[model samples]
Target: MNLNLPFSDNLPTNKLSASFANTSATYKFYWLIAIIEIVEKGQVNIKKREIFSRMISNSWYTVNYFHVSFGKQDLIQNAVEDILKFESLTKDIKKENLLSILENSKKIETKKLLEHFNLNVPHWFLSPWFPKLKDENNSNYKKRIYSYSQNFENCCLYGLYDENIIVNPIWIPYLKSNSKILKDFCYWNLSLFLQSRNPNVPDIPNKLIKPAIRNGLTKQTNEYWKNVFKELGYVECIFTGTKLLFEEKNFAIDHFIPHAFVSHDLIWNLIPIERSKNFSKSDNLPIFEKHFEKFYDLQKVAFEINKHHNSKSRYMDEYLSIFPNIDSFEKEKFSNTIQPLITIASNNGFLYMNE
Candidate 1:
């Protein structure tokens, strides 16, 4: 049957799975990616109910405690709860709450109504597709999806996946079928489950799952930078004269301009700064004259090392966003390129940090 997955032929070629696959691996992750992979391979009109059935059954997992020093820790919980909340609403009803709550609400209380609005829920079906696409039939089908693990018996006592038990499948699909892709679906749903489900939670698409689930970037990036830092050598904290090693744990990938205003993690903006300074820098843009030269030199070293290691570090794309017209990092004058960015931030209420 056609899965109605968008980009039915164009899933992410390099990695079948989403980023953060290692720590957040789970059923939702796998199923979403799997749907995308299947669609990319040419499937359409996949039943929404069947998709949820697949999720509910295979959703079984352990208490997923992620070492979340970065990113949203509650992403999965919010996604899942929102899915269930919307699922509980009826088509005939006016969606009284536009935002609804799940019956199993105690597990993850969405403290605020905005929590409901902010949910990045996934679309399991296409309300409508191209004329050539097969028609969706919600007719009753056997709920065949189920899940279990070799070590559930040993770990179920404390894992969150076991608590993420979803029941009865029914809900609205977000976005139009024609407007979305399997990757979008995968990331939306999987990010929620992965972020929320600690251990034992299931996850990815078939083509992506086979390898994506097995490989990850957190460790890889850390390892890559570890080597780069070793090769490029070390530096002392600019704010504090304390000697800081360039090792992963010892430092953080800091956004000198503060991500709040710059809103990008281009390699030029990124630097290995002491963790203490990173926290202290918070959302303030640094005085460019004080740090640009150092960050510029460090970015070059980091970029060269990343290119040698992975050639296509994801950060490069963001880097290009800042320099949309330029391909190579060579031509742009550092101050000329960065000053425009600082001005943009200044206009947006971003304050400068002298330190």
Candidate 2:
């Protein structure tokens, strides 16, 4: 997973390679990503707050929606959590909109959270280039790093300032030319760091950024439930209690445990609910204690029908992973499997309806 930066005679390739060496927090990785993004936009004079704001927005979904723990030491997750109290934004809010909101927010609390990084990340990220600054115990170590970066004859990544960092004219070409590779390097290292903290969490890399487009469930899954409705004559929405008819197509398939938490579309987790109710329930966990009996009954009926009539159904295999004996699916066994996932999703900050 090492990132081999393109060879450059003028730039310090060795320092770039060591940018994330022995990192305790995720600031450096995100700081570099923000820099690359601004550079790609053809901007050289970048605001420190802009970089910090991008850091929070970039990690927003990973922390909020996907519930990836960035460890107790990581404050980026904390900032994302704190902002929720002040704004009514969705976990899956678009990146550009999120960034604009962060950049334009007038709330002092928001500004304080972002500016806190200016104390260390701006200069500390350059420690790889100025290795001597590492051991300095002076109260003004950050000032010293800034001084060295500005006075260095060759090239430092950028010149630090009170409000912004000016990208070195020499490095601009290198940054823009290899922007994609440099970003890949940051994300590759970031994924490894997150994976260590979240050893049990699946799909670490994919969870890092908000998806451009979430893949919709395959038509086969939809048709499987449609067949269930056909055999039973009707299916009731678990959340709204509205009865749905198959011929009307007035139902939408929903994730029993919000797909944001599970990050999958397994058949066992999919259910058909009233189309209107599904819109309001977007990405929220259903109240399991209240909703489980009805959900389990519906799923059990689907399983039995599909197993007996359509023995070769593609989705029937999905239950075998959760219910080992598909022939004998018990409510208690299904409860044991789903209850903890709902609990974990709640603990990770996914909300329940009417919370």
Candidate 3:
């Protein structure tokens, strides 16, 4: 008998949050969570991945919840057709395991799958469409599928919004002056911003993403902005709503002005925010949604303004138009605006940088 636990509350610690369902590990992890919940709640008859596979096979043909009832078949089938029609070598391969049959498994294959999907659909939509995945070593079969779906979905979203309409400007004097601070700033900013998407206490040093910051002038300005936020102490993320105590790292570098819509990357625009909340704002507008009742004190003022300005002043709509969503822009902006947000940085002993 399946234990009737509340859906969200029943989630396992090891699984990915609903927000991270687009990622492969998270997708598999979510099912893992469900399986664990069944065991923890005292159901001895639960079959594992095999049962999941059976569920997919049984559910695949049902049009009612095909996207959620089946797993990867719907989207992956399109990819399979593209491969069979285009790739000369794939013609001889059987249609059953086209994903596994493909060569150059990682980059080339993944990119091809992404291109075939052509964006627009959320990767999570595939959760019910695929078979229960087994643990495979060399191929990382599941992750590749998830990444492919996410990439395509993102591309579609960006294409529709014209999110990448403008490129970063070629110049910024502050980034040139403070490369060291800027580098550290960008590293931590991206790291913390990514935390909510992987809340299982991320193994620190997860190989930070390097923004294409090459010029000396641009590097300096980036540092100055980070320095300012560093001086202000700590601020909470407006989205994920996670607050780091003084014992924890209370501060992060955020972009005051995002580089996507605004051409410049400078330190003068960086700011500090709490880590968890940063995730809630993922590349979208940062204003609190109606659901954020807990942040009433912080949100009451901004929410009203967003309504008044048509979501322009202090609202993230302008930048979000070209990014993932308002929430997505908030996360990216929290990650990108490390240089200018410093102006709002507060000074207190709670935040201390070891010299």
Candidate 4:
């Protein structure tokens, strides 16, 4: 890492400022947050190879993914399609040409926008910046980004691969400077960037997305669930073996299938429990066999209570979605309802425990 590059006196020009300047919004956003996460972990130098892999990896903590449904697909492919769709929909990008190529991008092999990120999009969209660029020669993209960061004046990241990265001392402090007002500022932009479809324009500004920093996949809050759980006959903490009070904040909703595996919030996967047990289970899958019979009985009771009440029918709706084939709630076996969901959860990487 080159530690001694002289800092520039001027703030970044409009062309090189905060949003990375006409760069692919989808690509830039992921690159930005990945860098933010890496820096936050106290590592300044980065290997270029790590960037792509990190983009696709899942975190155990629930990501308040913007465009939650689209966000859940094969992560990398989704990002690539987002990049292509962004360019086509951007008014300033080779708008006509990109739209024309977008049709080609949907064909058999290219249907998923099906080529390596570096080799396909630029040339396909007639990208003025990267036409003819291939992954082997992809250093141009990184170098250009480094130049933009240098001009942006925050001086957060600088350096080429191999010799090592020279992270600016000001990097973290500058981005984190006013964090209280703009928490996870970069991460929100990444979500906006990823979620953006037909950009109202090709170059959406970073300022526009900053306000969404406080948003995410907020699930049912304890207060609402507390009321619902009482009706579900779950008036106690299953883990702590203590009675629950509606006014207390100690209650939590547990995902019978670990979220790392299922990444779902349907009422079917959730149950009320003590907060402490949730912490202990963390992202691990539970041994449902131990508690299945009791839970099945309780859920049926809860379903019947809510079935005739349309407003509360969500409880029934979610129950039915999980056990669609079973006509009689009383006759439904624990294995019948759970087996299918567990199969899906396992394929997505959930593990099972015999106990």
Candidate 5:
């Protein structure tokens, strides 16, 4: 049936999928994109969530029908918490002003207080009113429509980030039906590979391998990188249907973009593909289409493999392209580390990073 979402009027009909497939696929689309933003960009900025919530509210049926697997949710929650912990370990923000802000919370004038502290927020977020588009029926409201379009576009272009790896291929149909092609493309990003769940550990699946790579959790071990992958999921390698039984599972947790090219080893640029394929793929650009095409139909493959549209690499390219002459290595380093941490830290507002 019709998903009576807020943006339904703006979008076309026939995109609705009343089935459970559509709901789950939509959630996966949202969750995956959000996770990628967090891992790569440092955080999914809270202000952007207001806009996301609006879009989601507009499409309630598509959202409610699909239930995210409990295992996926738990893993995501843990990852976010760990990153927040890392932020706390590195920086300190005093609670006095934060407490004062909470105590003096008034509904109307909080905007001024936020600005006084130099807090970055989108204008439309948390506000009661949303902008309306003008039809031929109303000439006076045209400017309002233009303003909303510009604001919404800006929010979408620069707002979201994250790197999530837990997805079931079963989501293919529902996403295909919605014709949210970009979302479908991202749902099974080839560059974002997953490990077979680990077998030795009961809760942890042996076959599963993490798609992203950063430094290990601690300074203690030599093989910390490998161990972290094992913990995350790296049970076996599936390369072009080669299920070869090796003496020891000779797999390497490689980056989607070779770390040699992109110094930052965040979640977006990682995957647990075969060591041989990783070697063959090397530092070259990610092969966006070939992997999943063999299994799914051509139409579904086309819908799911639009490289630049839904891919995080495209976002990174756009971000870097705007400031082409990034000469200062130190500035780059500081920007990389600080911006993401700050954005993530600000998420959930009062939930201290340490917690």
Candidate 6:
């Protein structure tokens, strides 16, 4: 997962590599991403607060929705959680809307949160280029970095000011010309960093951004459940207890644990619920104590019926991965499998419906 930053005789390419070395928190990665994004937009004179806003916005979904751990040392995650609580925002807020809100926020607490990054992130991000400043104890240590940045011979990434950072004129062309490569490098490193912290989490790379579009469940999955309904004559929605009619297609298939949490549509996690209930249940965990038994019973009946009619059906294969033997599948085994996911999803801030 090397960065492979474009070689430049004029710029200190080695320092760019060193910038990402021995990182403790996720701030540097997100900070660099914010810089690259701003640079791409044809703006070199950027506000430090704007970079901070982009850092929070970029990691919003990773922390809030996917629940990716940015590790305990990371304050960015704390800032994100605080803003969400302070602003009373939904986890799924759009990036543009979230950024706009962050930029325009007047709350004193919100301003303080973004300002905290200025203490270390802006000065420390350029530490690799100015290693001498690492041990300096001067009250005006930031001023020294600012002085160095103004000298093009030093080739620092950006010139820091009291309120903003101006991209070094010498390095602007390099950043803009190689924007895509530089972005991929940052994300590649970020994915590796997150994977180490969240070893059990799946699809770490895809979780980095709020997906622009999520693919719908396959037709085969829908057809498989339709067969289950047809054989049973009717099925009750676990969430609302409404009887669903297959003849009228009066049901929608959904995840017992939210698809946003599981990030998959495997048949084992899928169940038919009242079509109308689906909208209300979007991305929320169903209270396990209230819904698990009914969900288990419905799944068992569906499995038994499906196994009898089409034992080799591809839809049944998903259950085999967890259940191992379809004939031996028991409620206890199913509970062992599903209960932790429910708990973890809840811990990750997926609210329970009606809670």
lDDT of each: 0.42, 0.84, 0.32, 0.44, 0.31, 0.85
Cα lDDT tens digits for candidate 4, 1-355: 1111122344222211334445453444444454555666677766433444344322101222211222344445464345434434431233235334543444443333323443422222222223233353545655554444444233324443332344556555643443332324445544455446423211223222223233222354432354455664446554456765556756666777655444446666666677777777665555566666655654555445445334344455555655653345644555576755555544434455432
Shift of residue 256 alpha carbon in model 1, Å: 1.4
Worst 10 residues of 3 by lDDT: 158-167
226, model 6: CA deviation in Å? 1.0
Winning candidate number (lDDT): 6
RMSD of model 3, in Å?
24.3
Residue-wise C-alpha lDDT for candidate 6, range 1-355, written one tens digit per residue: 3567789877788998889999888999899889999999999999999999999999999998888888777989999999999999998999999999999899999999999999889888887888778677755667787778767436788888889999888888998899899888888888998888877666788888888987776574456876777787899988787889877877788898888778887888988888889988888888888899999988888888778889888877888767877776688879988998888777766788973
RMSD of each: 16.1, 2.7, 24.3, 15.6, 21.6, 2.6
**What TM-score fits each model?**
0.36, 0.88, 0.20, 0.40, 0.18, 0.89
lDDT of 3 by residue, 1-355 (tens): 1212122332231222233334432123222323333333444333332223222222222111111111234553344334444544322333224333442234564445644332423233333333244344324644544544334332211111111111111212222333344334433433443344323322322322212342333333233323322433433544345553434655454443322222343332333456544343322323223322333333333333333444443334434433454433243344343322221121100121111
In terms of TM-score, the best-performing candidate is 6
Distance from true location, Cα of 173 in model 2, Å:
3.0
Q: lDDT for model 5, please.
A: 0.31
Q: Where does candidate 5 have its weakest 10-residue lDDT segment?
A: 198-207
lDDT tens digits, residue span 14-45, model 1: 22222323434344454454344334434344
Error of 5 at 316 (Å): 19
If ranked by lDDT, best first, what sequence of candidates would result?
6, 2, 4, 1, 3, 5
Looking at model 1, report the run of 10 residues with the lowest lDDT sum: 141-150
Error of 1 at 103 (Å): 26
Give residue 283's error in model 5 in angstroms. 1.3
> Which lDDT tens digits does candidate 5 get at residues 156-273?
2222122111211232232234334443344333112221221111111111222234465122112223333334343333334443232344545555433432334443233345
Q: Which model is ahead, 2 or 6, in terms of lDDT?
A: 6
Candidate 4's displacement at residue 304, Å, is: 2.2
Estimate the overall C-alpha local distance difference test score of candidate 2.
0.84
CA deviation > 4 Å runs, candidate 4: 1-234, 308-312, 324-334, 343-355
